[model samples]
Target chain A: MSSFPPFTRLAASLPDHVPFVGPEAIERERGTSFAARIGANESGFGPSPRVIEAMQASAGDMWKYCDPENYDLRSAIADQLGLDVEMVVVGEGVDGLLNLAVRMFAEPGEAVVTSLGAYPTFNFHVTGFGAKLVTVPYRDYREDLVALAEAANANNARIVYLANPDNPMGTWCEADAVEKFLAEINPHTLVILDEAYCELAPASAIPAIAPLRPNIIRMRSFSKAYGLAGIRCGYAFGPAELIRPFERVRTHYGVNRMAQVAALAAFADQAYLSEVVGLVAAGRERITQIAEENGLKALPSATNFVAVDCGADGVFAQKVLDNLIAQGIFVRKPVARGLDKFIRVSVGLDHELDLLAEALPKALATARI
Target chain B: MSSFPPFTRLAASLPDHVPFVGPEAIERERGTSFAARIGANESGFGPSPRVIEAMQASAGDMWKYCDPENYDLRSAIADQLGLDVEMVVVGEGVDGLLNLAVRMFAEPGEAVVTSLGAYPTFNFHVTGFGAKLVTVPYRDYREDLVALAEAANANNARIVYLANPDNPMGTWCEADAVEKFLAEINPHTLVILDEAYCELAPASAIPAIAPLRPNIIRMRSFSKAYGLAGIRCGYAFGPAELIRPFERVRTHYGVNRMAQVAALAAFADQAYLSEVVGLVAAGRERITQIAEENGLKALPSATNFVAVDCGADGVFAQKVLDNLIAQGIFVRKPVARGLDKFIRVSVGLDHELDLLAEALPKALATARI
Candidate 1:
């Protein structure tokens, strides 16, 4: 073999596959912009006005690097969660944090578990790190917590990832069920409880943030509910002992400076967050109503997006998604066997949803043919 | 083995040491702010007005995620460099890219070579990835290319890191010298040529962008010259084949949306960059004059900072640094044995430099006592 800049054995073995292609790439390919952009579960209601103002004010200060320690933002997050500042670690986003978490916990060739069609970014990190991914499929459109614990024990998995108020399908396990699931996981297996959508989730769907556990890392993001996805800020909290190790492997200044400022401002303006939460709830209902009008069944969701079953198979659901995309209404669907029958739509601005409502019937008619 | 959240063997063995402590942390501890903030080599000149405007304009759009592909920014960088977009990869920063590059090339226990007392963050990533770092001492306050090349050959290093217009010292190697160094390296050993400060260096220091080599990855940043360090945007370009691997491991949306917008504007406003570069050169001269006035020798610099020799040992230089800090002026110094006698001071505004000038004599007097 040619020895021109040899990559590591594992890196060489990994395929070049991105988890999700951004809608921008599709727009570039199609030479047309999506008329209604609700595909990726981003909040079209946008960030709190205070956040925008804070970001604008800090624009000139971009010449200085961010506080590598992420002190203030982490402190605020800690205060809200009723945890010590040392128990929280901030990252570029949940995506960036997952990469660090997987690297820390999973040695190459070690087993890691997640639902088959859960977050693709987690799967990407596991494979990128050369860990064996043992996936347990969803049961009844929810992450099968019982199966995940069993798989973790069976494979002696190093890490198990579960997204509460999960993505692709917005079903969630209640607090008590999650508490029982945690009890069943082996102590050696680190649980990555990603709650990126938690702020948009029902209060009943979330467990109390206190009484932090060593084997569990609960991650939350400004991306989903706070509507700061473009800024790329997220954080993971756990026991201080578990959190301290992140310093060993993190890109210290990976979190952007403006992100810290925006997140701090976003966090402080609880009124705006409450408003966005209310708006998101209303949008979800609107989407469900639209789905019903089109003779599809929308799954019960605690997330910012709703998964509407197409009343058909995976292929038919895919055709519906394609037809929606062609009609300039961007949407996505789960790719796994059982979940693929559903088309996922994010809560959007009223105008965007109106466009979605206008296009759904035509998309369905075309998809049926 | 109590078995509570077991980390990888490498992570378990790692110490919880942050590479560099932020100035904010120091202020929090001291309960006082630095009057002159020039410690971390960030541009005191700030980013271009157009860049700031771009960032402010895009603040409200933070609800949308950054394009994971980094298409427009990469295209702009490619256009500026006269290279195909395929040959370049954008990252959070040179620090972030270093983490990816090290993980891509170095397996556990593999040797990675760098000059001793170079960029600490690079060393952090090297060790963080379980790579053994082989170091060569700088000769005459400059990174010793001959020693580094020999070290790589002797140790069979998987990767060798070299920062042109080197950090902590602000010294640079000429293009011809670097070309010779690259020619001597084994093709199997990848070279991470960091030119983060290249925009501030003389044209003779930068190698031509064309005639890309598979084994050499040239990394540059918007942080130093464009004055957008807080935005955390950097790029690396090399042979397209080598650049392709970065996609396999990078956090798809790690680069922030505001960062991309800010960097694009910064790159476009070359006139403003030229103006900042001129101001930086003037500031460097002023700093050199301040060192001379204080009866200390200032090392020649190609970057934005001057390393002032205290005319004593590392201990004496450290005293001067501590006294300067205590006197409300922020600065840093090299810690490696041979270079530790010099206190590194970044170019600041005239008023800040005056504060440095006024404090330097008092600091030296206290050190001498």
Candidate 2:
């Protein structure tokens, strides 16, 4: 074998794998397109027309590099949130920001706390950084905030990650309860509240933006409700002191110029965002109805997706997911132990949801066999 | 004072600063736009029409996240270079890939070798990762390849970074010399060959893609000759084993979807690239003549930008740069000791170059005072 460069012990120790298999990969592997693209939790309603127009107008100006500071976008985000621009740092995506957070807050061998079945990308980063993961299992389909706080104090962890209106399960904890959890946690640990799906969530589930705390970094994204996931834009707001450290580690020009332009336009069109939220809510009801017809329980959700229980074990849920993929219906399921009995489906356009409604019965029937 | 979350030892020790102040920041501070946007080395000619068309067409499809694997773009790159798909990885930009490389290769307190004045972004990442930077001085305004190789071996450095068609000086070492340097280096040390401006350089300066080395990662970008700097897309290719590990640490969806489509279209249009090359060459000669007209010497460049010696000192060059900026002409200068006596100007649109020609003598006369 040819000799190779030596990777750091930490990097070499991590598994060489992608955290999630993107829908494009599955399509390439199957040699057929998914009839319903209700997978991956992306908005199928697309970005606002104004956002697309802005992107198209700036297409010829792609020769210039993006602003390294992300000043304009940061200012806009801060303006909307009633915070100083220094309190916000825009990144390529929330995933990118999370990667930086792990490096900034957690050293090698330090502990990071999270719920067991939360966003895998956060776990991937903690592992890549050689940080020890202390996971708390979900309590009754929601993140066990009290257990997570206890674990953080017990382990003296440097960072704790929580996603409100959580992924895969689409369950959420009330904002007031989350605030209580925050108060109960050790002040030395940084809390990363990934609010990517916040816009799709109910107003009560989102905390008021005021009184910024140094120990908390709240992340928001254009990906979920703004419908600009493909553009790769997200922002994190925290105390100015904490946000300043991001300069030391972030890829300065990682957020593309087109992303900045599109995000700014999307942020301006709150009307479009509200319309999409209503559409998503109606689509979730349709999915719930569809699950009822199949005699399965659809979990109550606050985000864009609904998780439908397969009424059996993890094995049965896996079979159902495989059968759905085989039938050219793209959907994902939570893999964590208690959560594996459910399949998660994002709200897509009407035709896409109709196709999912058509495919679920056949998929469930096949799994029963 | 409010208590803050505990940051890592490395993160705490680093200075919170931007490596380079972007022109947008300058514009914001000065309250005026640059009349001639020839600084930062972005192409004034812009990307091809087809690439723009592709970006505009995909603007509405921003709801889907990018492929984590970057499969199609990697396949096209591998096919063009006659390498296997596994040998390539696409990133947000060369800057993003450099961030990953530092984390993967250099552990805290380990050494990384580079020229005293190379890409500042690379230096930023090295410091951010808590790696010691071992610097070698430039020889004759070009990177001293022999000294760099020696430093890597002596320090037992994990990474040695060299930009072919070196930045700031716009000088290059021939392919044969680079190969010799590569052969003499420690096999265990990784060599990062940043070929960002390779397309503008002579073919003799670029080594053949065959005979892949396990220790070398060669990076290229659509940011330069392809005129897509704002899109944030670049790729690194090397042996498959080394490439695989990037997946472990990379932010999977960091590269945006429009970037993929625009870059693929950019890659397909080699004719536009050649035309840009011809334009850049003519522009370089014009800059050289302008330098001579102002009683200075313009260094021969293999890259798109020309570095003109001020025929005085670093102070004179700084004054000239300041004067240009005062007149709303954006230009940059090298900050390292020997290279600091020169001012660098990127080729701009014809009218912008004409503005440069009109502004030079006045700026020089004011600097002489």
Candidate 3:
């Protein structure tokens, strides 16, 4: 190799592969647009009309950089969560916040615990920071809390991640079980409760904001039920001590003003959020029905997406995903070992679901073992 | 000290202070908004009508996450600069990109060089990554390029930052001088050439984009002449080898889709850009004339903002700033040693400038020592 500027051995060891391929890239490669655009679990229903109006109304306000403190949005989020503003720190998205939390807590070479195939973004961050990942396998398609707690203790991990109503698998452990996990995990481990999908999940999957536990930081996203994923806004809530460290390294002005406006307006429209949750539930049921018609089993989900077992190996699931993509649909499959047998599908608009319905049988037949 | 959770010794020593307090925070504290919001070098003229229309046109597209690859925007920007897409990387703002650059090149305790009172955000990033900052003094109110190159070699610095037509001082070096500085700096030292004010400056102030310059990364922003600071979009152009490492740690979806639409539209309209640049040049002249009417020497500037020597010490300059603030005319002043005698004012709309013109004499009298 030609002599190159040195990277920290940690950085050099890491490959340039990203955790997820964005939808636009897929379109570019396929030389076609996705007809149903529901793969990322974004709310195709869109943000509240009031939020769109707010953003359009403030287009001229683009001259000013967003408030780094995110004072107004932080206050709005704090009031809604019934916590002090000091307990919440808003970020670019839940993804950005996860990176910050991992950097703050996990030292180089220390193990970070999480359920296998939970949220790969968290694992990406851990690996990016050169922290070792200790993954516990899922049981019953849900995060196996007891096993994760033991792994944290055995590894003396610096952090443990759990996403209630998890992505990829679309499974969950209820609030009581989460509390049990918190109590059982190594006290030294900082539990990052990623609830990015919590708003769409059954309320039972979320806990009352946990401020007493200094080791727990819970993250939530406006991208889910709020329908503002493109704007990149999310916040994390925790004890002041754990939350305050984000100030040290965060891109203070990373979240833009439009995101602030959209999120604030989204928060104000509780009626709209209630409607979105109901629609997501309906979409999930509709997708499950589509899976049944295709002779596959749809896993019971507490999330906005359902994971349908392809009734064969990862290769078969891959074929199903490829067929969908070739047919101009954009759903994805989990690639982690056991989870690879299922293809994940996000709830979409009626037309999009119809497209899915129209194509699933064809895609399934294409993927026959 | 009371016992606390352990932070790395270096992190524990870092202070909690931010590089700058925002104008919004000032308004909240003062219980009134600024009549002339011109301190931060933002385009008070606002984004192009076409850009605003584009954002409004796509207001409904906020449901999806931004393309992680930033495909279209990168392609547009790279095409504009006559470079390959691989040579360009978009970030939240130059501030966010600076953080990533420092993280990649300079390990903790490594030396980074820059002018004494250049862009403090760059210094903030350097300090953030635990890099030692070796600052060369600004001579003649402009960056002393010879001294900067000397210091870079002296310290064997990994990065050297220079903001032409610099912030706080508002001065520039011609293209030939910049090219000379680049040649003098060691190949191992990555020079971050921040041309944030490039669009507003004389063309001679910026050199031709040199894609082969392995030692330099030029930072530009939509936040300036494009009038989209609230959008949090900026890009760095450099050799592919240096830019490739950014992918290792960057938040893939950090840029927003609204920003992409707005920038693409902004770039598509060069006639509007020319009109805005003309207005900026006019505004700078008006600001300079206003400062001279009060008997303060307005430094010759190639940027959107002008630095007026308050004709006294740091305290007097600070008084002028506070007096402007008290009169609801928001302005900023330098707090560093040599530059503390100057107050910086940005170009704003006619009425906003009139507000500043009306406040200047009174604020000056109040600051009289």
Candidate achieving the largest DockQ: 2
DockQ score for model 3, please? 0.62
TM-score of each prediction: 0.99, 0.99, 0.98
* Fraction of the reference Cα-Cα interface contacts (below 8 Å) that each candidate reproduces: 0.90, 0.92, 0.59
Measured with C-alpha atoms, the lDDT of residue A134 in candidate 1 is 95
DockQ of each: 0.78, 0.79, 0.62
What tens-digit string does per-residue lDDT give for candidate 1 at B53-155? 9999999999999999999999999998899998899999999899999999987798999999999999999998889999999999999999999999999
Rank the models by lDDT, top first.
2, 1, 3
Show model 3 residue runs off by greater than 4 Å: A1-5, B1-5
Clashes of each: 0, 0, 0
DockQ of 2: 0.79
What interface RMSD does each of the candidate structures achieve?
A: 1.6, 1.6, 2.0
Candidate 1 overall lDDT versus native: 0.92
RMSD for each of the candidates: 1.1, 1.1, 1.4
